[model samples]
Target: MQLTQFTDLGLRVVMYLAAAAPDSSPSTKRVAEQLQLSYAHTTKVVARLSELGVVTTRRGRGGGLTITELGRGASVGWLTRQLEGDGEVVACEGDKPCPLREGCSLRGALRRAQESFYAALDSVTVADLTRAPTRTVLLDLTRPAV
Candidate 1:
């Protein structure tokens, strides 16, 4: 199952925050620039992360984002599940309803497969994803250019 760009960017934002210095809080714009992404996209991702309680954001001067302990310790699978939400793998029924909406074995199989995918990641954490080289690179992004 493919993750939406929003979910992908959210993971990156969380990783970046996890790798940042303990006392550092980078602004949304700064994060966007560092991540080489559009400021608007970054802002949206940040807002979602904040709402999820994984990251905190403030406004105005010195206002920036910091990952909460929940963010640091959160399992990759759990976070992805939260970001991805509880939506079915396929729309199944929408403006153009599926003929098999009544009873579809494929839909149930897909749901189980999706859950398996997430469960596979349950053992990994954001810290695990940001370890070593990744952590180093993300940490460097928070540093002022010299």
Candidate 2:
């Protein structure tokens, strides 16, 4: 299944925050400007992420947005399962099953493939997005109790 632009942008925003220093907090505007997303949309995504406990947002001076510990565990596969699940694919979400459901092997095949696709994504985490020194340093910085 193809990822919607919404999920894509959401992941990107998280990645940008993850890439920065732990104490480094960037505002939604900064993230939007850097990523070329509209402030409104980015704000919405950030809000949603905040609601989901994926990120933390703070107001006032020296306050901005930061990726939450849960954000690291938000794997690509988990994202796909959440956003691009069986229902996200319209053909599967319909009240009535597809006419070819019984006779078609394609549907089952596609279902299995989709599951596999998301399973692969699940293996990757925000940590996986970073390379070598950055990842190690960042991981240490974002350690659990902090």
What CA RMSD would you report for each candidate? 1.2, 5.8
lDDT of 1 by residue, 1-146 (tens): 99988889999999989998888888999889999988998988898888889999988888889999999999999999988888999999889989998987999999999999999999999989989878788878988667
Candidate 2 per-residue lDDT, tens place, 6-106, comes to 77888877777787777778888878877789999899888878877888999999889999888866786775555443452336436886776667677
Give the residue spans of candidate 1 off by over 4 A: none
In model 2, which residue pairs have backbone atoms overlapping below 3 Å? 77-121, 77-122
Cα lDDT computed for each candidate against the true fold: 0.90, 0.74
Residue 76's lDDT in candidate 1: 96
Residue 101 lDDT, candidate 1, scale 0-100: 82
List the pairs of residues colliding in candidate 1.
none
Query: TM-scores for all candidates?
Result: 0.94, 0.76
Model 2 spans with C-alpha error above 4 angstroms: 85-102, 132-146
lDDT of candidate 1 at residue 16, scale 0 to 100? 88
